[model samples]
Target: MARPKILVVGAGFAGVECVRRLERELSASEAEIVLVTPFSYQLYLPLLPQVAAGVLTPQSVALSLRRSRRHRTRIIPGGAIGVDTAAKVCVIRDITGDTVAQRYDFLVLAPGSVTRTFDIPGLAEQGRGMKTLAEAVYIRDHVIAQLDLADASHDEAERASRLQFVVVGGGYAGTETAACLQRLTAGAVRRYPRLDPGEITWHLVDIAPRLMPELGERLGDVALGILRRRGIQVSLGVSVAEAGPEKVTLTDGRVLPCRTLIWTAGVAASPLVATLGTETARGRLVVRPDLTVPGVGGVFALGDAAAVPDLAKGGDAVCPPTAQHASRQGRRAAANVVAVLRGAPLRPYTHKDLGLVVDLGGKDAVSKPLGIELRGLPAQAVARGYHWSALRTNVAKIRVMTNWLLNAVAGDDFVRTGFLARRPATLRDAEFVDAYLTPEQVREHTASLRAGLDGPPTG
Candidate 1:
């Protein structure tokens, strides 16, 4: 008889961890591991701002799927557009835009998430995002290009508009992006003899009452002070009402002339979740404590795609879609998959958050590890240490560490590399936002798959 095929969708932290665990735990005769994802690398999302600010190269954060300890995984360069639970088949749209169906005895859904955007006028077109590596690269180039144009211009009005930068969402991503990029521009202006350092302005806004409230009020204030101290206009309880080509209108009737608008507001679960036709809470699949999908046999879901119950918190509390939780869930889910195969007992998934860490660029940072507050160089060490230790490969760690040391000494050259071919500046182009299929399309594909294969296979 053929070995059981385990198909895992997504190559995010959760999916990658699941694959690594499965490879480590399962033997060659036990099962075949298949991973479907659009990208070949697992993006280390926490330090993405450092990539944007030139503190770290984009390659350092991208962990290759093929370079694991054991080469057991079969990687498909595709995105899972839909899952047919009854058929035990997943419809994947590959990088080339062709759809294919693969049957699996067990399925793991970890499609991850996309940038959460609003219907504000001109937001999608005029605004930029920091979600993908391409976005980070593009944002870096765009920021530098703006400085170049601003410095070259004799037009005071154009220079003023070009020098202004606006970042929406006061959460960790936005706060860090603003702080790091603010520092980047602040330092880069010293190279421009024609431009005054004070001419560069950065505005950070969020609908929340406080910046990084998850860090608690004390650390939030500490973060706020750091940004304000750096001359970044930190606005709370306000957001962008509209984004334009030349400026943004604030919800509180304030207009800021800016050429750059970065939207790091939040993330919504991948649209693939909707194609599963399952119970979902807040746009994520609702899974049991053991990370199994209810009413779906041999199916498990985790990460940003699944609302895995937080047994530690109890009472309908699903785990937050964070990398820390996702990594743990991946391991537990893999073990559960094995238990299912061997007719053994399964384990429940539960973990309390250790704490939060916010890197505020340079030697500044704020962390609440194990509920103990820390700041400055000490917090910076903790934050960087956690990230370095979490990296899966030695090369990634070495590159990141070397980049940090080199950047601290030499600083950013502020040179736009223009590494990405064609230079995709929009979020949809970079993120493949419209790639997922509808339920009906999925059903149609399932019908075609059944006819072609003469119904689902029995292994």
Candidate 2:
């Protein structure tokens, strides 16, 4: 008999962890583990700001999937465009645009998320995102290019627009992005001798009442103070009302001439969820405590795509789309999948909060591990130490550590790869945001193929 195919759609923290666990527990005869993702590497997303700041190379944070000792896992370099639950098939759009159906005995959906964008005028065309490795790398080059252009321009207006930068969001992602890149320009400006450092300004704004409300008042204030001390304007209760190539209008009635706007506002569940034709809570697919989608046998969902109930939090609360929760959910989901295979009772997922860490580049960090809040050098130490330990492989750990050391000692070469220089780095150009299907479309496609009317997969 053919082995049961265990298909996981995504290679993010959750999907990667789930596949790794399945490979460990199930033998070659038990199940075949198949992973679907556009990228071959599992991106360590938390340190993306460092990548943008020129403190770490892009490849350093991208953990490769083809690591040693995997017996049953097959990597599919594609994105799941739709899922046909009744047919137990997943339709995928490969890198070259061809489509195919992957049938599975068991399925895990962990497609992660896309950047949460808004209806602000010109934002999609003008604003940049900080969600992906490509975005991070592109931002670094783009920021440096601005410095180059500003230095060469004699016009004060052009210089001001070129020198000014803006970041929207007060969460860890946004705050750290603004803080790190501000540090990047603060230092890199010295190399461009003609450009006045005073002209370089970074504005961090959010619609929230305070910065990093997850850090509570104290540590959040500490982070806020550090940014202000370094000349970053921390403006809460405001966000980009409109964005254009040369200027930004704030909701608080402030107009700023800026060429760069990095939007780290938040993320929504991956579009894959919409194609499943299932219930969702604010964009995330609804899953039971056992990580199973209701009425979808042998299928599970986790990561940013699933609204897995927070058994720990209890009552209506669901797990937030965080790396910590996703990683834990992956392992538990693997176990549950094993139980389903053996006709055993499935176990529910539960985990306590492990606290938060914000690496504000260099020697600045804030951490609340095990309820102990820390800041400054102590926090930086804790933050890096946690990240170093969380790395899945020794190779990744070594690469990241070497990057930190080399960055601290030799400093950034401030070189741009220029591969993506010509490409516009906005959301519309950079992200595959359009590659999605409606539930009705998914049902139609899968049904047609199942009935042997399979023409070209795209048809």
TM-score of each: 0.97, 0.97
Q: Pull out the clashing pairs in model 2.
A: none
lDDT (tens digit, per residue) of candidate 1 on 1-459: 999999999888899889999999899899999999878899999999999999999999998888876977888888888888877889888789887888999999988888899889988888889988889988998898889999899999889889999999888899999999998999899889999888899999999998988899999999999999999998889988988888889999998888899999998999999998999999999998999999989999999989888888889888887889999988999999999999999899999999989999998999999999999999999999999999989999999999999999988899998666345477777778888788888888888566666655322
**Residue 206 shift from truth in candidate 1, angstroms:** 0.2
lDDT of 2 at 117: 94
Report the C-alpha lDDT of model 2 over 66-174, residue by residue, as the tens digit.
8857745788888899898887889898999988788888999999999999999999988899988999999999999998888899899999999999999899889
Model 1 stretches with alpha carbons more than 4 Å out: 419-424, 451-459
Show model 2 residue runs off by greater than 4 Å: 452-459
Q: Give the Å shift of residue 278 in candidate 1.
A: 0.4
lDDT of each: 0.89, 0.89
